[model samples]
Structures are given as structure tokens and as C-alpha cells.
Target chain A: GAWLGTAAAPHERPGARRGAEMKKLYGTDAAKIQAMEAALQLSFDRNCDRKQPKYWPVIPLRL
Target chain B: TSISASSKPGADPASLQTEQRARSMMRERFLRCLISMANKKIQFHMYEKVKVDATFGASDIDVLNFQVSDLQTPIGVQTEALIRCQDVISYSFDM
Candidate 1:
């Protein structure tokens, strides 16, 4: 009921939508997959924040 | 649904569950492998036969980019860098 025509619908939230998609894709093990992805993403974000790593080459190699 | 191309359009529910479980197991194992690679020396093979080594850090959830440290390039060693996954043809590291 709260979601009806609401601006902050569940689908509007990327994280919530991702979790829902994972559930549809992974079924009973969605939580486990989601946890792994979250941890991996967290480490990437933390490293980028702390290291301030720049992209090498400064240009796309493939395109 | 975003089911794989191989999945039949009107597949039964039980078979769909089986397929999803299989996919989850495969993805979980792949993620575990990526986790184990952290801090290890990884050699990335790129186009034009260019190769470089870096201490593995972490990859984005989408696997589009890899954040690494001490990247050994042709010119000099970069203290830290992010490699676009699209540029990489393959990568390997010791267990």
C-alpha cells in the first residue's frame, strides 16, 4: 500500500532492486550471493577511497 | 525474466529453480576465487601482446574495473591504478 504511486518505490532504489533481481535469479541462495557481492563491492569502494587510484593509460585501449 | 538464453520461454517452475540454483553456485564459486586473488600478484594480458603485473586489490561487483596496487607498466611502476576489464584479454596468478 505504501508503495502505490509513491516516489520512493522499491524499484526506484537501486540497491533494493538489485536484491530483488538477485532473488529472482538465485532463488533460495540469493542472500548468500548478495552478501558476497556486497563484500566485494565494499572492498573496491574502500580501496578506491583510500588509494585514489587513477585509471591507467588515460584512454580506452579497445575503443 | 532475465533467465539465460538457453532456458525455454515456458519452462516449468521446478526446472527454473534448478537452473537458478546452478547459476548461483557457479557465481558464488567465481566470487570466492576473486576473493582469494586479493593481495596476490596478478599478470594481466592485454591486447597487442602487452602484459603487466599488479598486486590484486578488488574488482567492482559488475567486474567492469579492477582496482590494483603497485602496477608494473612499461614506463614505470604506478603506486596504484584501476584497470578497465574490457582492455584485458585474460589474467592469471599463482594459487
Candidate 2:
């Protein structure tokens, strides 16, 4: 797998894989996001859709 | 009292025909592919590239296809999907 990542800014879409329990999944500050993304070196947003239908997340920064 | 674990059997011919029919049905769905090699070759030579991308929604995906770019062949003219979309999710391929 060359790349596997979620959309950036999980809170923006809110319809992420975590469901309404998004807060419980990522803490209030996004530590899980950092860890998963760091481990994979890929973007991780709670978001599902990627690119097209309007390219987004800009560059998907790690920070 | 236990049944034997090792069992060997042959496929029934009627079942085999059913499997063949299934394959035939799928092939028929893509009838164009059933045409002569020359025909496929024509399409193959005509299109330089083919792209596939998915568009997911709140609960499911809406896979889409559209030509992003092409110089030698007709683009955005052909598209297919295994599942129908319930919402709008468009995508395009670029040359």
C-alpha cells in the first residue's frame, strides 16, 4: 500500500468513521491523530472522502 | 462418533452449467468485450489511460468516473460502476 489516510481536520466533517463518539476516539486534542498519522506518515482526518469533489486538506500537514 | 474430515467429490454437470451461465451472463453484460480482438484492440489503442476513483458519502460510497484529460481519444464518454450511487459524487480524469 503506497498510501492510506483519512481526510484532514476530523472535526470539520464530523461524519468520520468514529461516529458521534469522535471525541472519545481522539481525546479533545488529537493525540491519536498524531500517532496514527506519524506511524503511517500519511494524512489521517476523521474524514472519509479524499481528493475530487473538490480537492481538500490542502497539503495534509502533519501538524 | 464423528464424520470423516477428508471428503472428495466432483462438481455436478448441472452445477457446472450454472457456473458457466453465470460467467456467460457477466460476459454478456460487457458484450463489447465479447467482440473480436480487433475491436478490443481498437478501444485499447484508442484510450491511452483509464482511471478509477471512489466517492464516499455519509454512509456509503458513490464511485464515479469522468475524463480529466485526453488528446487522442474521446474522454468522459464511457463509464461504469458495480454499485449505483445514492448521492452526487463526481470525478474526472486528467490528461
Candidate 3:
């Protein structure tokens, strides 16, 4: 039987697989931090009774 | 790590104070995160494609180790375990 292959098997490379895995596993640090902030919004401090109590706000950096 | 910025030589006092404020804020957020994770089932993603689940108990101030319960490892389930923070790349749990 005759078969055909793509021009370049990019996915076959180890580096490509690792790159794809990393992309799937973790997001950009900034985005991850944003998601963490969102999650924290829903969580209450163990010492607190309210849903979102008085928590210190993270100061924004100038640069 | 806790704080990355160190006041540079000849840096203005005002900027140094600002940097300290930022550091405290970040540390506070991280502490709050730890508190929220207490008693929650967390899934840890480690290096070499390893993943494990455990009930988070507590972590030291330095965050070098984590005290967990019912740690599900490849060998067997441990009643109580101390996981090295370095071994974990990331961990998460729903609120």
C-alpha cells in the first residue's frame, strides 16, 4: 500500500511536544495571578466568618 | 520567594516605602491563600508529569514544606505527609 506524509512532522519532535504540554498545563503568570485573585474573591479567610471580609488589597506596581 | 525587591543604593525614601507596601500586600495575599486552602482537597502538579491529591493542613511561613493529610501517592495512601514545596510546580483547589 502507498501512503503520504506531511511536509514536516513538527509534532513528532520532543521539543514540540514539551512546548504544547507546557502551554496546556500552565498559562501566563499574569493570567494565572488574575485567576487566583478571582478565586480568592470567593474564598474567605479561615479566621473570618463572612464570605469576603476585610482583606488587604494588593498594591498595584508602578512599573 | 517572599520579596524580590531590595532598596537600591541612593533610592528615594518615598520609593522605598512604596516598595515595602507592595511587598506586604503580596505577602498578605499569599497568607490569605494559605488560610483559604486549609482543610481543602488540593491537587498538586509536580515535575516529570506527576500529580497527587491531598488535604492541605498547613504550611510554614517560608512555604518550604506543606503539611497534608491523606496524601495519595504512587506507592500508597499516607495518613499524614509533609510535602516538599520544591517538588511541586503548582497546586490548586476550588473555593
Worst 10 residues of 1 chain B by lDDT: B3-12
Which residue pairs does candidate 3 place in steric collision? none
Alpha-carbon shift of residue B14 in model 2 (angstroms): 0.9
lDDT of 1 by residue, B1-59 (tens): 67655443124677668767887899899999999999999999997688999999999
The candidate that achieves the highest DockQ relative to the unseen native structure? 1
Please tell me how candidate 2 rates in CAPRI terms.
incorrect
TM-score, chain B, model 2, is 0.27
TM-score winner between candidates 2 and 3: 3
- Highest lDDT model number: 1
Residue B84, model 1: Cα distance from true site in angstroms: 0.1
What's the residue-level lDDT of A41 in candidate 3?
33
Candidate 3: regions farther than 4 A off: A1-63, B1-10
Best-first order by lDDT = 1, 3, 2
Q: How far is B27's C-alpha from truth in model 2 (Å)?
A: 0.6
- Alpha-carbon error at B70 in model 1, in Å? 0.6
User: DockQ values for all predictions?
Assistant: 0.47, 0.02, 0.02
The TM-score obtained by chain A of candidate 2 when compared with the true chain A: 0.23
The DockQ-derived docking category for candidate 3 is incorrect
Q: Which ten residues in a row have the lowest lDDT in candidate 3 chain B?
A: B7-16
Q: Per-model C-alpha lDDT, please?
A: 0.84, 0.26, 0.54
Question: Worst ten-residue run, lDDT, model 2 chain A?
Answer: A1-10
